[model samples]
Target: MRITPRPPETVAPADIDLFDPERFRSGDQHGAWRTLRETAPVWWHERAGQSGFWCVTRYAECERVLKDYRNFSSEHGTILASVGAPDPAGGATISLMDPPRHTALRTQAMRSFSHTVVRNRTPRVTARVAALVDRLGEGEQDLAELARSLPMAVTGELMGIEEQYWDRLAHWSAVGLTPEDPAFAVGASTAATLSTSHHEIFACFMEIIAHKRANPGDDLISALIALAPGGRPMDDGTLLLNCYSFMAGANSTTPHVINHTVLALAERPDLWRSVAADETLVPALVEEGARWTSTPYHLVRRAVNDVVLAGVPIAAGDWVCAWLPSANRDESVFADPYEFSLRTLPSPHLGFGAGPHYCIGAPLSRMALGVFFRELVRRFDGVDITAPPQHLYSNWINGFSSVPVRARRRPAVASSMPAAREGACAHGTS
Candidate 1:
């Protein structure tokens, strides 16, 4: 459906510069977002110099929105921050789309990202992750670089793409996810960038699909292509859109989670120290980081049917952003939500989202995090950092281009560990 921006007066107040990506990038946004959650849990945010959105801060209200698909639709493409960005896929990707169409295509695309697929691809993933850690010697260093490299490289390898394109993939993924910052807004250029990448990726997929069509292989593309809905093959557009959905928001979010998780550890030494001591706790650390980082902080939902949340009345056509970073730290739900805790239990964090739209790649993300962190932590006994991490300026991705992490020579936790103890990282730390 074509959507033209309504008149300025008709726009909601939540659309404003206050939600600008630059503002959040300049500083950690938790404090301000937290204040709003408490003071005006469900408030309108219309600021000068930004697209408008309604911010839902409290956990209960956010839950109400996520679980009740009828009340809030995920079809609007899931981002309230980058209101102006154009999707190169012609319309909504899976995450942005509502069900039936979204569900059918997602079932195929999700097959590639399934746990077995990610597990099958782990050896390669582990090698890249370990190489990154090996370069950083034991010392105080920038955590962001250490965090981002694993997922950035993983995204490429998993897609069967060459390593050369990791930088561009990371860039696009970051840009698409965060819109509250100074990162370039979506427009003609974004479409160009997206189109360029899509062209390459689609070409690659088309080749693979054709190969599978002619001579079948065990790779995911083949399996997806083999899928027959009522004895007919999946169409090109559905297949392409499904694959595109996998690469869209995930690639950026993965690295951002890694960067933020490590950063969180650095800040909360207690948490970091705990995870380092017991590698088993690393999974919890990963979850906490993903929850706290809130790199892809805003998730948009359209009112599927009129409903009320947090005592606020809603109507169909109205849009809402479940400010996840804020919701994850809801005072009512978490004890000292602002305080980072590796020991936190039964985490109800919305990092992977909730209900049907909950990220289909949850297992892949979890597996990646498990392999990346466990191997790194186990290998580097004295994997101390070199210095503080730098932050990226992009509004869509909370990450760093460079983090100078030169670590000391710690005993190898395993035989095949990637040492990024020292090297040139793609994105620098803030």
Candidate 2:
């Protein structure tokens, strides 16, 4: 599926079923996306059971769709499942709303994951991640599983859930987001499984909400409960949906970025050593990983009115998906788009998306990534992939299903450890 340098003016729509669940099962998706970007920046994708949708492949076109909510609206939904259909959440989720109303809900939720809040929570988050790293012990481990544990810990803390529930919460989050994924497949009926799993998760959230209502605390649930939109506390149903939103936001996506960052940096010892030596570069490394991984490849939007995007006619009521991963790798937007570098990146990536529907969990995500990588570089000199990583067969999430890797702890320097002094100096501390 690799796109040749010179592709045809457009792709054969039949060959590329953008809605196919297996489309992303191999390395082919990347090339397929590249071809779409070059040949049909605004490509049409025909779904088997439903009406066809347009895929906005280039950075400009994707950003245009994301930013211009007037023409391309998210009110229908922001994922492929909701295309040409009403959002199951009934647009109660902030990510599925348009301006004004979206702004209010997003603002309320952002308070819980604001910069100051995340900065304050960093120490606990870091300590939690460090403990997880230590628990990795001295053997080959599935880095993906280890990475998955992190958001559970952090999000668990934010939601005031017991640590024991983290694993189940993570599982539910995965099953909820990608029921079509083989790991969560219970039978031929994925939608039914997802529906049942979501209800269970919702019940858990209701319990948390009920608890928070009676005994409010300094947790995200409390903050959300305290949130009053249009002069009244947000409804219980909205609260439940948003709480689930926060969990899914943190649980499902961040791990992919973490796994990708670890695998990518681990493979490049030179880059790993540079970051290990200087902690300041960790942010850049994290940013690069988000851009490189593009966890949620594309977000769905529906046309509110007829529009011409990149010379293609998109009719009113048409479903469109803005390809974020493709946008991050757009040649015109990024120099040497394929090369992974920690240096200052080109135009900021749309990994967390854009406009009013931008990811509110970004601050928390950064905190998790920052702590995870910093701890990883500080503790392990090398992370070698002992076996090929098993990738998730998901069109939405681009990540490792299992990354088997051996961790090589940094050798302890004897008594007057110059390495310790060098590390301190590099980190600018005593």
Candidate 3:
């Protein structure tokens, strides 16, 4: 199935700039993406003083680029910030490597984030999520702030990080990914902020690595310390880079998924009531939320060999970016792509990505979302959006810096009633 091409007059292609943070912040990127997807699914994006790249917006093309790692190398970089330059951490970090090494490192890391591991940790995760949910006041509260603490708390103890350092790590991860956002700008400039964040996070990991080396525990860091993938032990540089990768991956996307889910529910009262009445639907909601949010909006890969994508000839060493959010909303792949519906089960959306480089932390992120929403529906009757969400100023992460919400506690009677009875009551049919 092919997307119906839109009229050329409808979209001003010259004004579209995929690298501009303001396009995303102003929410104009969605329209631009739609235009691109329909008109030029595989289009060249040029910028003055920088090398141009191909933008893959449709579902099939995006998936093809991600899965075809041989032709499209990640060794150069995985974000536009490093475009036209080699990433120092490229071959060393798990996120920036190709197979064999990538496979070995991911296999070692997968043990800690496996479904069994996440399942075992669920009870504790649920307890923590419940406690956090219980602490919310009745009036307006920043859901973004509440969401930020979750991934750190869940992954921190799993990684043997001290509880006191979770908040700091979360802050640094946010800043590192989206330093251009004023909310995270502590240094003189965006580059300075990014440098400071990277320095602090690496230093923190170094200290943790030293402690783990002395007092090894049943945790990820310790396991990595013991792991000798390919008969070569990991050096501190590799360890620190992977540690930063893990922390950033764990902390960045899940919170935005949570915040976006709540905000979506708040806007759709009927959907909120349905999920609130039936906790079983929470999993479906979680899946749909991940699809809807599509955080980490785009991923960049440099072509290792010349290849033709969607009829467009891409040359060797040319950078290619797959717009994940755009792919998730492709008209041919999703029916009513713009609408948020829980019925989109068995979702083929590239939310966690596709192929060998798929996110290793996916199971952990899914577990956190499931536990959080289950606890949320049990405690809250409904949530209301108090104001517009403050979106993060970055083309990389499709997330909010602030989401003000007012939640109403579930009534005592409603809490005690059965699911069917609660549904009936919610509909005023009793």
Candidate topping TM-score = 3
Q: If scored against the real structure, what TM-score would every candidate get?
A: 0.77, 0.90, 0.92
Q: Which parts of model 2 have CA positions greater than 4 angstroms off?
A: 1-14, 345-347, 413-430
Candidate ordering by TM-score (highest first): 3, 2, 1
Ranking by lDDT: 3, 2, 1
Give the winner by lDDT. Answer: 3
lDDT of 1 at 395: 49
Candidate 1 ranges beyond 4 A from true positions: 1-18, 47-51, 81-92, 108-111, 114-124, 138-149, 152-212, 228-234, 381-388, 411-430
lDDT of 2 by residue, 62-117 (tens): 88999999998887888887776768775677777788788887776677778998
Estimate the Cα RMSD of every predicted model relative to the unseen true structure. Answer: 8.1, 4.6, 6.1
Kindly list the per-residue Cα lDDT of model 1 for residues 1-430, writing each as its tens digit: 1111111121232433345556655565665566667567777666566545677878888877787776787765566533434234423455666566657656876667777788776665655665666555445555554554555566654554445655655555545443322333444565565455556656655665565678765545566677765467778876766556666656667776766565555445565556668878977777887777775676777776777777777777677778787787777888767666774555888887786678876777787777667755655543333444446655445566545554444354444443332212432221
Angstrom error of the Cα, residue 78, model 2: value is 0.7
Whose lDDT is higher: candidate 1's or candidate 2's?
2
Cα misplacement distance, residue 332 of candidate 3 (Å): 0.9
Q: Give the TM-score of candidate 2.
A: 0.90
TM-score of predicted structure 3: 0.92
